[model samples]
Target: MDEVARAFLLPSALIWCLAGWFAASRRGLSSSPVFAGCWLLALAGNLSLILAAELLVFYFGFALMTFAAYGLVVHQGSPQALNAGRWYLFMMFLGELCLFTAVALLAVAAGAATALGLASYHGLTLGLFAVGFAIKLGLVGVHTWLPRAHPVAPVPASAVLSGVMIKTGILGWWRVSEPHGPLLSDWGPWLMFLGIVTVFYGIASGLNSREPKTVLAWSSVSQMGLAALLAGLALTSPGAGHLAWLGIAWLVLHHGLAKAALFLGAGLFQDSQGKARGWIGLLLCLPALALAGAPFTSGWFAKAALDAAVIEAGQGAWLPWLLTAGAVGTTLLMARFLHSLWVTPEADGLPTRGPWLPWGFSIVCVLALPWTAWVPEHVRDMANGPLALLSALWPVVLGLALYMALFTRPATAIRWPWRPRAFGPRAAIPALLPGLVHVERRMHRWSVVGTLFMFVIALLLAALSLRISGPVA
Candidate 1:
């Protein structure tokens, strides 16, 4: 690796070390072995990436990171967590398989001259990379694992999972694909469709969730949908590359800081005794607003930049409306999250104050940083205008109105069958199995072996099919 590349990896490695030390010193080596192992594994994976000079190395690093994350998700040692972890692992492995298959195809097609760097391939390679990365990005139908996993993880872990880990997929997508066309050409519309579906589904599922954390998980799903839209725009228009990068960078920075703060605040609120403070409520709202692209916030900058990119690409016709709908959906989801907060049972016993510095600093960053640095002046000026302010405000208002009508109504008056009956042990077994339970269970103990076997089987099938078809005369 080059000196610059090694330097880039230094910070990640340091953070990994810090996390390991913290786990060991604070929790002890004996306690939560799984958690410690996962953390270490993630660290190792991340470090491997830094050291890696080839695509194979990168894939290996990513694998380590993902599996370790899976361990962390299930480390809390609950039945719910276990189930969630299984789902998480399954999705992650599926993504890995897709990525591997894509890489293999690229290598095969490109032959001996293929470069190991992400930028080496185009066309079919790009398609495979997109599918592989989209799985991790939690795009639409492939997103089922996210809602289940995020809510089940510990608060800190949830923060990292939602805020940081998912963004890696975005980074990967950016690295692998080159942008060189008009926006909305080729992959743009498809991504827009995926983004729209993800946005709506996330909001709907979030609204359906009774748990506060669960609602937040769905919110992450919704927010990433917007990120996907921005990414698609970048892909479609090479001219908008800088803007796209800026949008992604801002999204990553603001969303990570803000979401982490909110998740921590939720944990604090859940753990606190007596009445939750007015300040906690206010602090929580800040991140939610930022997420909804409120004026003067990082999200607004990202949204504006993304909009500009689409417009510059001459693909502005549908995106504005799509974005507006996405905003409204996000607002509704945030409203549901807030309502869940209000109704959540207060913890028993005296509340102990946790260290508030991290969350406080994060919230401050979300509110202040964008105004000073991230966004362009024109966009910022527009965000301050009446029309933009109204656009942002109306969604919150509509969400509030909907919440009052549907969620705040008396339980007796609502008559809905959405809530499933609590499962007994017998019922839970069937619930756990779903459709592929038996197959999954049989494969579970032999997961690595089974996975390898499946890969071989798939490759052989492809080869057989190719041979049968012969040369395309």
Candidate 2:
């Protein structure tokens, strides 16, 4: 409907369609009509949310997408898939509840917000929106469901979940809230700092991970954090406007296509052999390299565009270094993922239509993306000159150099400053998280889950009606 909608909708549609094609080509659970229907339903919800001009429409579409994806996550009926679905559904409902409540408050505050500015209406309403969207984005504290869900779900489902679905959080935030305003003076710095923490946390956790899917999931968390940095900068910087949002949108496009390709490639890596195997692995590098901001890649152009926005935001002194660190971290994560693909055991059989068609197309799209007209004309020329080229190239080079010196051989590996064990709270979650086991148990019950589901829908509808019709006398 608007440029903002187009920016968000284009990537969502592209990734979902590609992932859908890849999903349909698979065997087993993915081959079922039920799976296809669920996939379509989820896609509808996703696209609807992006196109939504009304708050109620947005909330309903979000709920539809969230609930429908549970079917995809559990389609295989594996113990792991079932468990992951439970967590996914639980966290999703919690976020939905918060978002629904936030919407009602926003509607009620519409008059006051116009006078005082929306964000200043009430900190609770905005905070609720932030927490709700943050969960969707897979930020640090609320990210437990993401790593679990990605590895257990079918590959195509994982692709869309990470590449497309997670980004709705940013879009939702943009729709209803401003990153900076009188009431949220502290929010910009806070989100920016949290974004940094999330980046390092993802890198450390992903580096320690051997499972390629889990690493990819962690990388999603990191990328979302990078997007947050841009959003926060836009909030704090007076000069920021369309440029900042455009940068974030381009980021969503770049990461969506690249991450989708990576997940799809990961799916096929197990089933591949002979020339097919070689091609899949080789082509996987394009998206991975793009993610690393390697020269001539979409990552290169996207990062360059983001750099321009950061400079425009007047954070030129430190933001470039921060982005460089993220680029280096992404390169390491991709290296870990590529290594796992080689070491992973082969699948018992190939998919029905073979692996190359959808996945190869995805790779081609990722590689050719920058040449497309989706990018702003100004950003198209951001990488001009040798200095700009070097900036893009060095992060990738440093990452590969570190990988060669460290992870490649045991003798060259460094353990001096610290031992190379699993370095994050990921391993210690059960011990660290309060009553997690009990909560997981409660979530497993059908009666409890159904009740919760009904409750959320009813509450959302009630809030919407009460706000729209006014309070009873």
Return the top candidate by lDDT: 2
For candidate 1, write residues 362-431 as lDDT tens digits. 5676677575754566456556668776777776677667555455545325544542244221223234
Clashing pairs in 2: none
Candidate 2: stretches off by over 4 Å:
109-121, 178-185, 349-353, 410-473
Whole-model alpha-carbon lDDT for candidate 1? 0.65
Task: Tell me model 2's lDDT, rounded to 2 decimals.
Answer: 0.78
lDDT, candidates in the order shown: 0.65, 0.78
